[model samples]
Target: MFLGSYFVLSICYNLYLSFFRNSKYYPDPITHLVAKQSEALVDGFGYNAQILPHHAELSMKLIVNQVYLARIIEGCNAISIMILFASFVLSFFGRLKLSLLYILAGLVLIYAMNIIRIAVLAIGIYKFPQHTVFLHSIIFPLIIYGTVFLLWVAWVRIYAKKQNS
Candidate 1:
C-alpha cells in the first residue's frame, strides 16, 4: 500500500510539474504561491522582500533589499514531501478516517513550516552570506525533514491503532 500510494502520488505530482513547466503559468502555481507566501512572511518580519519570476528557470527569485537571496523552485513547495508523508501515514496502522485527517494536518504543518523555512533562509542568506551553504544545505532541510520525522513518530507511537490478538 505504501509503495503503491507513493508511486501514484509521485507520478501525479511529476505530471503536474511537467504540465506546469510548459504551460502559460509563470514559474508554476505552487512555486509562485510558496514564493509569494514567503515574501509576505519575510516582509512581516520587517525585511524588504520581493519575488520575481526568473526568466531562465521555472522558479521565482527571492530578492531581499535588492539582493538576490534565493530561488524558490518547485521543489521548495513541499508537495513531494507531503506525498511521501501521506504514503507513510496511509500505510501505517491507523484508521482510515483518522489517518487521513492526520495526513491532512501534517501536510498543512509542513507546508507552513516550508514557507517559514524559506523566509528564514532568505533572511539568513541576506544577513550572513557566508553561512548560506550551511543554512541552505543543512539547517533548513533538517527543519523540514525533522517535521516529517516527528509527524511519522507521532503517527506510529501516538496515533496508530494497536492490533488485537
Candidate 2:
C-alpha cells in the first residue's frame, strides 16, 4: 500500500515538476545553452547550418512538457526518457529513497542523449538538407519511441515486474 501511494505521489511530483513548476527542467537549461552554441557552429566549425524551424514550433507549442509528460505517462521517452521513467518505476519497485538514484542517473543519461540528438539533427540538416524532414519528423521520433519501448521492456524484465515476482 505504501509503495503504491509512493508511486502515485512520485508520478504527481514528476508531472508537477514538468508542468507547474515551470522553472527549469532536465535538458532544458542545457538544451537552451546548446541551441545558442549551435548557432555559432556554422561559422566556427565551417559546417553549413540551417535553423531548425521545429525548435520554434516545439517552443511555441510548449512541447517540452508534452515530450516529458508523454514519455512519463507512456513509460517511454527514448533511452533517456526511459531512464527517467525508470526512476519513477524504480522508486515504486525499489522503494522511494533508492529511486532518487535512478532519477539522478536518468538525468545524466537524458542530458547526454539530448545532446547527441541535437548534434545528429544539426549535422543531418547540414549535410542532407533534403532528408532533414525525414530525420526530424520520422527518424528522430522513431529513435526516441523505439528506445522508450525497449526501456520499458527492460524495466519489466529487470526491475518492475522482477520486483513483483
Q: What are the lDDT scores of the predictions, listed in order?
A: 0.89, 0.47
Give the alpha carbon lDDT tens digit for every residue of 87-130 in model 1: 98878846777777888899999999999899999999999999
Candidate 2 wrong stretches, greater than 4 Å: 1-30, 34-92, 160-165
TM-score of each: 0.94, 0.51
Best by TM-score: 1
Can you write out model 2's per-residue Cα lDDT over 47-157, one digit (the tens) per residue? 543323233222211122112111111121233354446544554465556455655555555545554555565556556767867887787667655655554565456
Tell me which residue pairs clash in candidate 1: none
Q: Which stretches of candidate 1 lie above 4 Å from their native place?
A: 159-161
What's the lDDT for residue 7 in model 1? 98
